[model samples]
Target: MRKLLLLLVCPLLLSAQTPADQILAKAKAYHDPQDIWPTLETTFTFKETRPDGPDRSTIIILDNGISYMKINRNDEEVYEVNGEVAEVLKGDKDKARALVLRNYYLYLWGLPMKLYDKSTPEISLAEDEKVGDKLCKVLRVVYEEDTWYFYIDDFSGRMLQYKFYKDEATGKGELITLEDEIMVDGIKIPQERSWYTLPEMKYLGTDILEEVD
Candidate 1:
């Protein structure tokens, strides 16, 4: 009798979650099946290519459990942040940019999982969007001043692209298309990200993940 009651309540519990919750769960399962991101400690080595500049190489070390991060560009120190304080070791000494990059790296690398962060105010199911030839389920996340849309493959639950708008009404923002994946520490992370202007689709650049440690 107890086993029958448990089986009956399981489906009901799952169905009670909103569409946004379900989609996020699927996406998270694909990206971080082991659920190890909260205490994740890893190093990322990547190359950045842009039409306007020469290719650049960057290395980033992150330990999410302690909120610690360090970034290096071309073998030179860019910045390091531990907890709330950030320091720029060389170059311009821009603490502001360092802090921003801290958030930027963590958020981008942490993907659908980061969407569940407490700092994230809202996530909702949005109309489906086509990424290239494949149709994807869309998730809209609202921030204080910006709105972001993430396109996830319906069947595989992998993130295909994401766009953020400063002006939601005018759709003035950038679109980032994800390609390929790198498996590191049991996590599937997008290998390449191509950036373009929203409506114009002006080509910007691509960030390619080369290796991880």
Candidate 2:
């Protein structure tokens, strides 16, 4: 009886791990069809829509870790950064804004693909969830700084939306919807992201990928 119970429990434990692995594999394939994160070279235009003000646009060129970003709001030529060295080619630039812009672009552009990186958070399967009317497979990612929940489409395996908590214990978080998709170098990327405060569902701004190369 003891041996039989052990045998039964082993398969159950193994089967439990299978779903998360399968979900991750499908998501990776959908986002990075060619597996081109390491050598990804592309240029795209990012536009931010504000609730109280006019829209802002920036042209961003990313070649792996090196990037060149140009903002239309200012006369500051082009801000270029290669590894640790950063500089402006034409006019006065705000270093603080440049840093934030660099992280903002890189993080958004490298989605489900970047989640697979070793330095990123550890990903595990969470209870199944629903985003609006769509049923999704929930993925719980625990990073060093915060916890994030990702909702992947049940049928398509594409990432539909994600949420991050400001205070995990209190369940205070924000949800971001990934809407629209475009292909860049065979990889499918979310073209627009709309953010909202969780629970209350207050509307934030949207980031639009206007152009891509």
Candidate 3:
């Protein structure tokens, strides 16, 4: 009778302690407790440094899904897109560059918090792993086009690093270390990100969030 009782209780406890549920709860609380994105209205500056090229700076403003991006490489205002309308403000902006910048800023600045988005991809818990010196709880997210691995700090429940695969089968990808943070309007945003090539760990450019509001 005692063994049967223990078995029943054990199953209940396991169901109550799913890894995805626990990790997501902590992640959401740490990153965006107030759900700022729906009414998010803010501006920030991104300074990018690359080993192969001159530094580039951009000022980005996102007001409720409408976006304006200014590319400072040549002191040019390159793109502006709002709802159904899109424009190339100046300097012969191409659609490819515009799209890259759009996704780049949106993805990096809105991380961990963005994991909770309504359109968020399918997410599941993976085995725990160490990122740099910190042990992390791994969350694997699969989008339509790519798969991403987010490493949440085991102790603080904060996202410390992430990896993305260009080809999931080959596992060739990049890893980014998220460092420094600033709280803006109840959102914890990473202020700097350094990227490195996977396996080889080649140094890539760093994107620094210089200013925010």
Candidate 4:
């Protein structure tokens, strides 16, 4: 009886020995089919809609190395990120703040898409969890002195959810959750993001992206 049990479990164990690093490589190859991610500065438009209101604007932006972003909504200015205030031509403080928030939100939620090339310490297989009905292998990641939890589907190896625990400096810091599915260049990507902050509040947003040349 004992021998039979060992025989039954041996293959399952060996087949499931996928580390987080290996899974990440496979995921990048599968998810980023069209290579739309920005490696350098680029400007493209986006249509943003909220339940309370809807708006269409030209999302002019720069993504220099290190994720520096400068976004202009139509002829009006609304966003900037990691940019020097002296360099900006806009004088509206409200627009600057909006730009900064936009940049921060976009950058945080748009990751795993951006985590395409980064490699860090690889951890052994942790556990398995289900994000939807799909079974995923949960992996723990520590980057930038911050800890994060990720779930990647077993077969497809695509990242399903990325949860980041904010550092202690901001006593009111919180957790970031990225979810949902968005199709980009025919590839499904993360579309919904729930930014859970301290004081028991959350900023929930969704990005329904359509790929345009």
In model 3, state the lDDT of residue 205: 87
Among these predictions, the greatest lDDT belongs to: 1
In candidate 4, list every pair of residues with a backbone clash: 79-99, 80-99
TM-score order, best first, reads 1, 3, 2, 4
Q: lDDT per prediction?
A: 0.89, 0.78, 0.78, 0.58
- The digit string of per-residue lDDT tens for model 1 on 131-188 reads 8788889999888888999998898899888999999788799999898999978889
lDDT of 2 by residue, 1-213 (tens): 999999999988778766766787788888887888667888888787979777877777778734444433333456776654666565666566566667667776788877777777657899998887888998888876678888998888899999999788877888889999988888899999998987789998998998986
Of models 1 and 4, which has the larger TM-score?
1
Which parts of model 3 are misplaced by more than 4 Å? 1-18, 65-74
Top TM-score model: 1
Tens digit per residue, CA lDDT, model 4, 43-138: 545555444566545464656465566666555655556644413445456645665655554555355555543454455456787876889876
Clashing pairs in 1: none
Q: Residue-wise lDDT of candidate 3 within 31-142, one digit each (tens)?
A: 8878776567887777889999988888777775444443344357567656435566677767666667676667778887767667886689989999878899999988
List TM-scores for all candidates, in order: 0.93, 0.81, 0.82, 0.56
Candidate 3 steric clashes: 0
lDDT of 1: 0.89
Candidate 2 — what's its lDDT?
Answer: 0.78
